[model samples]
Target: MATSRLGFSFLLSLFLAVACSTVARQLRFVTVIYRHGDRSPIKAYPKDPYQESDWPQGFGQLSQVGMMQHWELGQALRTRYSGFLNKSYDRQEAYIRSTDCDRTLMSAEANLAGLYPPEGSQLFNPNISWQPVPVHTVPESQDRLLKFPLLNCPRYQQLQRETRQSAEYVNKTRENANFMAMVANETGIQNISLESVWSVYDTLFCEQSHNLTLPPWVSPNVLQRLKDLKDFSFRFLFGIHRQVEKGRLQGGVLLGQILKNISEAANTSRPQRLKLITYSAHDTTVVALQMALNVYNGKQTPYASCHMFELYEEDSGNFSVEMYFRNESGKEPFPVALPDCPQRCPLQDFLLKTQSVISQEWDHDCQVPSTSQDTEVIIALAVCGSILFLLVILLLTVLFRLQAQPTGYRHVSDEGEDQP
Candidate 1:
């Protein structure tokens, strides 16, 4: 009996040890996609007093408020990952990529200023209190993979058109017709549609955010409707009809790339040089990625909002992907659940669930005929061409024979082959 008790105690101890170790998994990597900080409205509606000259940095440029917003974000990041990241700046440990836009690039620089405040020998100038950390970017004209609102995607455009014609869309449009027309008249923009109403709202929102007075025609109710419209637009942009198909073409491309990075980071054989990767881009970029993940909250993501991917390695030789979103500057990032997934979702499960949305060749899928459709068209065209070719050959042969036999001159009239 004593021997039995001793064996059971040993087994219990081993089980406890394993359980504790499993709970203490290590964070292997992190990928964060954040919107650029506040900015002037990209453009103003017709007859709006605010213009390019109103902003010191010109239209669409990051403002002083924007810089401070990102600076705070950097501080938040540093605080959130204090022990997980190196105390000193390590180029090999982190990678940052941004859209090649003035606002996005500048936001990245500002965020880095807070994220990696120079310490020890890394500080170049004691008075400046900042160091230059490289923020890499591909020009907007050349970048399609990382940025959202991807242009020239024929498939996505077709999906958008279909979505607009969907019953839900038509109902919404009909319901909002009176309000939309009111906006068009008040803003003095002759052809303002649901798609373009955001610009007017954005102009008003930005001006209000900075405490500027608004036009008398605008009211709190008007602004609320505008905000609602913008939210609807984002949903329409990414999640309307055939949500999965739209995702596969637009945002899923980026999601797949991010998953690839997570898998590589989790691999034990790979030389884990990169601990963190950050994408500095627009709010649309954030919304599109979240929509593909099926975690979007159907609201416009606030400026400086960040969607983070945290990769973890468990003691049982498994990896997991955890997501969080920080849409408010003053608040902690909330957990974003993948559908039917645990907060710490297993990497294999993550891949399995997202596989349907992951696109292999985004451009090819967006531009050309689908493989099955193309095959049917090709077969039909081939059969038709073969029949046409035979007819052409027969006609040419008869003409040749007739010409060969007609060498002898024969008097011919317009009537009945000259009655010869």
Candidate 2:
């Protein structure tokens, strides 16, 4: 009887362990891309009262509110990933990257402060609670990863031109003609198309967020219209037409990097120690990424919004990816499902589905057909070839005539000698 009771307890303990292991999936890797916190307007319209001098740090700088926003977001991230991440900052286990903009860099620092406050041995100074963490960045002109609407891409520019000519774009333009004219007149911007209108909206939005009194022309209804147009512009730039090709040129650049990281994490044979990677970027970065995933909701990404990718390894050794978007403060991030993929999408399927947008050679892909330089080169070559052909023809004709004349003259001389 004693032996049977002991055996039963042992079996029960083994069963519970197996059950717990099966119920909990092992989170192997985490990738997070977040928009920078609140910022001053990038630029003001010509007629606006506020100029670069009005902002505390001039145009496009991060404000103090932006700093606090990132700090809160960092704390939230810390809480959510407390179990998965290290208690203190570990350079070996985590990497952080930001765009080379002041706002994004500052936001990354603020977030790091909240995410990894100094603890124990890491505490350098008694007065300060934060420890420095490295944030990597490349210059904006060269940064193809985080910057959206890559202006240097001629093919992307051609696509934009095509998008502007699309029926939907035309219809939107016609419908908003009067409103656009009003904005143009009031803002002193003569060419207020969909592309340039967003700047006006951004300046107003930033000013309102900071409790500045807007002009009478910018009524609540007008502001709402501007916001709607701004959202539409986001969709227009990324998704209006030839979306797949545009994705290949724009957002796919960043997506390819992300998928590569996930692949490395999923590799069991050659495992990487890094568990978390974070990108501090702008709202446009968020839109570009979501657009590539075919999951953008057509709403402007808010300040400090975070898009997270969590990779998990199941008990059966299969790996999966789950996505979450944390747009609002004080709320749980909502799950984002890839189009035609399950909520917990298998790693292979995710990669296979996204392969179409992943450009193997981004620079080569951005090349436009019949570029002006190419056309000029072709024309120059054709002109030079024609000139060379004409010169050869002229030389050949002159040689033939010279040979014929010499033969006739020699025959005449021989006849004259015989007569003598």
Candidate 3:
């Protein structure tokens, strides 16, 4: 009886140990990257549904809907990280960063409003729901012009040029002809650019309503078609199946940052995981990062779309990273499961399991296949053209040497006078 009693105690202790480890494994560190919430178009082209006057808040400002969207996101974070972030905010534990844009800044603020609501000592006023915390940012001008700057990376620009010029992209644009005609009809504008068509499409879709005072030329069929085109474009940008591989590569920088952060967190020795790392930037910021991580799944990644990456250290001290996305849809985010790990995969192993994903996602060609289709030939042609130009210049120099006047030899006229 005594021996049986000891064995039961030991088993109980083991089970408790396992359960504790499991709970710890469930929680790791977290890094979230998100775009700002819904807002008006930054600026409309010559023809768009909402003129500046249409919105009381003006263009690019976060709407009340946007605020609610972020507030929901914050609440979600609070729920998700309830045990992790503590009931109160701590400077040492949590940090938030936002782009200088009003929408993003405000979005982050709204999110925090949800993440860390006031409780106990943290509350300045007893009646308030939350205490205010700082959301960080650099100047918008600097962000746009310099520092993590977009100086038109020649490589990305070249890729963009190639992507735009690709038969697929060109054809897609051409197929959008009906969309162009429809926008032209609505705005009463002549010769609408492909981009203008998209701008108008976004305007109408975002307004969530058709123009009440539609121009006489506007057709309901055209409106429906434009809406379809808009959906297609959003799918092209963020959908799982449509966005090309190259875009996934071009936007890998932010994804790289995500992995790097996980790696750092995994390397740390403590119960404290990276509480939070918030990225504040444009819609492209979210898209690029998502594409690199191969997570966007070709959705529009609306303003203030936030991606949460979590890493949990297991009982054996192994680490894993789990990815989560919030897009103001108030739905559970799409999840990417890494192999050799649980629902929450270890960071290092996640990186390894996902290396192929990263490689494929970003369109890196380091391991070119033995065979390829037309793209390879186009690449070969460019390379050969470059090499041929170099060779031609070399040949020209040689020919000039063979046929040219010798040094120290001068031509003389019949009078034996050397030419000057």
Candidate 4:
């Protein structure tokens, strides 16, 4: 009976240990990247009647619906991570970054209002439900580090040119040539191209979403094609010829920064003060980050869509990273998978997979010399030579004319004149 009792106690102990080990996953850190909420179209097509005045806040400014969209997203985040975050606002616990655009800035502010509503004595104002939270940003002009679809990278521009020249791109263009031509003719938009079609779609999409009547030219099929082209344009922007290199210069810069933050958060010796960091920017930003992680679904991320990176530390001191994207306001954020890894990938493996795309010198890689550089130099030298040739001809003409004419002081002998 004593032996049986000892055996039962040992079995119970083993079962308890197994159960504890199974439930030991702890969330260490979180990073979120989200597109700014809805807004008026940045610009309109030639035939578009909806002017800036049509929008309540004018063009490119966030609408009231946009504010509510972000506010709700913030509340969802609050509920999702309530266990990990503080009950009240904590400055050291969270950091927020946004692009220097007014829409994105306002969106961040709105999001923070929902994420951290003051409680207890923290509420200074009784009527207002919002409190101020610091949002950090660098000037858009100098912000190559965080911005996506980075416009200043010369190498990236070169890649775009190459991609356009690729046979696949050309073939796709050919396939859509008839459709694009029809769109241009029917819409009365002059000089329309595949690249600029997205703007047209955006305007129409915004109008439709806001319940404005669309032009007769914009049929269901037309809308679908517009969306397809827009998705293709985005893919062509970051992919096509040398996708990995393009990602490194554009998305990978931002990814590198995010990785550094996660790495710091994972360091157990540190205070772990920063539990969350949120980036509020554009749809392009969300797509670029996902593309860099090899998880893009080739669809345009909806407005106010969010991509979340979660870090978990197991009991054995191993850390893993998981990614989720909340594209729809109604549904839960879905898990995203990394290439050749599980949905919840080990942190070390995540870093290793992304090692190739991590840019060492962003400015250097972005300025990578191409054959076009030589072409530019040649063109410049040719221009200089042409100018020099013109100057030389002018000088020769002046000298010849001077020699042909008599000087101000001339001798009486006309045939062989000499200065007195």
Candidate 5:
């Protein structure tokens, strides 16, 4: 009886030890890339919500509500990673970044409010809102100047064009054509292009949210249709078309940057367990990065949706990366699982899994331009296009006025009008 009891106790201790070790194994390193929370409109369309004058926070600015959303996210993250990073603030073990947009920069700050608070040696003031943490970023236009995603390779542009002409794109064009025809018939508006539809949605969504008055024609049904258009436009930017090349443009390059940071951190023996990189940008920015990594479906995810990727190194020197998505109203983050990966994932597996991308039309050797050069191009194009567009609009307005003149002024041919 004594021998049996000893054996059972030994077995129980062994089980507990294994369990503890496994738990510790998971609490090693973590990396997260998330989208910023809700914000004011980036720009106004012909019929969009609260204009620059109407928005208290101004265009593309994060509001108080946005702050709350990020704060909640920070709280959730704090709980989830409390075991891995720390229960409280640890400056030596964490970093944060934003995408250099007003909303994103503010979002990072708000998130940090929940991420780090007074604890041990990390607290600076007792009654402060929170300790200050660095949320690094460059000029918004110069974000691409940092290197990885900033290649100016001609081959990449070629691949982008190829993707644009692919079977998927052709199908999308067909779908758009049908949808446009239907909409034109319904609204009695001819030539309803993507731009027109997108403008309609942006105006409605922004206006309605900020309590700005909608246009006379902006009914519920029309508003819904406009939203659908926006989703389709996002898919065009992300899933159906530009994902692989975009991944090559952004995440593929950023992945390299992240690896470099990790390698340096490991070599230097730094304890930055929470590499809390932040990106401050628009919805398209989120879509571009997500789709390139083959993650987003060809649909709109939502406002303030977040994507998190966690890296773990096992006791045996094996590395793993787990992915999770937190939309606004979820009880728990959804696992972004793959066929080969379960909940607790591997990094190398992620690289390998996303390697194929979605389509077969991507070029591996595209070079992204420096951020300055790209920004310069955008500025030049915008200036020239603005001038041209104004001229076109003015000319069209005049032409329309002329055509709309009374028919009585136009000479009527009185050939055989028998006054029926």
Candidate 6:
């Protein structure tokens, strides 16, 4: 009996040690990219009863529901990373960046309000529960990091043109031609294509969400069909054809920055002070990142959706990356695995798999080889070279004529003068 008890104690100690070691895999860093909360429609359809003035804060501004959505998201973040983050707001520990838009900027502020509510000595105002947390942004025109589907990319534009002509796109267009025409006629839109359909759907969806009475024509079935098209449009924009190259031109830019942050955090040589980096942006931003990662589900990313990256240092000192997506307010974020890699993807493997999508030279890659420009340059050079060749030939002919013709005492001049 004494021996058996001793053996049991030994086994218990071994099990506890193994469990502790497993639990010691510390999270080194975290990065979150989230869509801004709900907002008023960016624009209303011409035939729609609701106009810009109908919304309390005007067009594209955050609604009260939006503020609450972000606040709840912030609270979720606080709960998810309670132990990892400091109890009080620490400027050194966290950074938040938002696009230079009214909705996105406000969403960031609201999210921060929830994530770091003023506590103890940190409370500045007794009357208000909220404290100011700095949210950074740049001019919309200048911001390439957060603002996605960079329309300025010539190659990306070319890709869009190509996508339109693709069999899948053509088939969809052909199948939905009557539907699109009807929508265009109903909305008073002059021409409706896959790209423009989203706006109409967005207007209706926003109105529906806000309890506004949608037009009689906008039936439940119509709304559902519009949603399907909207999702397809997102896929078409990001991944219908030549997805890898598209990603390089569009989403890869953001992915490169994310990978860089992860790398910096993983470096054990440096003092790892920063814990969390949050990007408060739009649906397109979330989609862009997921598309780059090749993990995008073909669905419209809802408002206040979050995509998280957590870098962990394992017991063996190897770093791994894990991704989670939280689209719903009530449910936990589900794990998203890197393609051909485990959920806890090794740092090196994650980098290797994602390297193709990461643009080495975005500007160079975005440059579509302009055949017209090249042809013009070649033609100009040819014209100049031909003119120079003709000039040389004319000069040589003139010199030959002077030498061969009876050039007024040209050859015999010196001898004739001496003889004379």
Off by over 4 Å in 6: 2-6, 370-420
lDDT of 3: 0.65
Q: What is the C-alpha lDDT of each candidate?
A: 0.89, 0.93, 0.65, 0.88, 0.65, 0.93
Candidate 1: pairs in clash = 413-418
Flag regions of model 2 displaced more than 4 Å.
1-18, 370-420
Over 313-409, each residue of candidate 6 has an lDDT whose tens digit, in order, gives 9999999999999999989999999879999999999999999999988889888787733788889999999999999999999999878876476
Residue range 71-155, candidate 5, lDDT tens digits: 8878888888765666776666777766766777788888888777657666677677687778888875566522223335565
What would the TM-score be for candidate 6 when compared with the true structure? 0.90
What does the lDDT come to for candidate 4? 0.88
Which residues of candidate 5, in runs, are more than 4 Å off? 1-14, 47-50, 119-127, 145-192, 219-221, 239-243, 259-275, 355-364, 367-420
Error of 5 at 70 (Å): 1.0
- Across residues 1-420, which tens digit of lDDT does each residue of candidate 2 receive? 999999999999999989988777799999999999999999999899989998899988889999999999999999999988998999999999999999999999999999999999999999999999999999999888998878898888888989999999999999999999999999999888987799999999999998988999999999999999999999898989999998898888899999999999999999888999999999989999889889999999999999999999988899999999999988999999999999899999999999989999888888888765388899999999999999999999999888777544543555457552
Error of 4 at 167 (Å): 1.8
Q: What is the lDDT of residue 371 in candidate 4?
A: 64
**Cα lDDT tens digits for candidate 3, 152-214:** 344344444455566765787888777676667657768775434556656655565322455
- Per-residue CA lDDT of candidate 4, range 1-420, in tens? 999999999999999998998779889899999999999999887778788889987888898899999999999999999989997999999999999998999999999988998898779899988788999999998787667788887888888888989998899889998998888887678877778888888988899989999988789998998999999888887776788898898788889999999999899888568899999999888878877777889999998999999999987989999999999997899999888999989999999999888998888888858566788888899999999999999999999988998669655767676759
Residue 302 CA displacement from its true place in model 4, Å: 0.9
**Candidate that scores best on TM-score:** 6
Provide TM-scores for the models.
Answer: 0.86, 0.86, 0.72, 0.86, 0.70, 0.90
The lDDT, on a scale of 0 to 1, for candidate 6 is: 0.93
Under the 3 Å rule for N, CA and C atoms, how many clashes does model 4 have?
Answer: 0
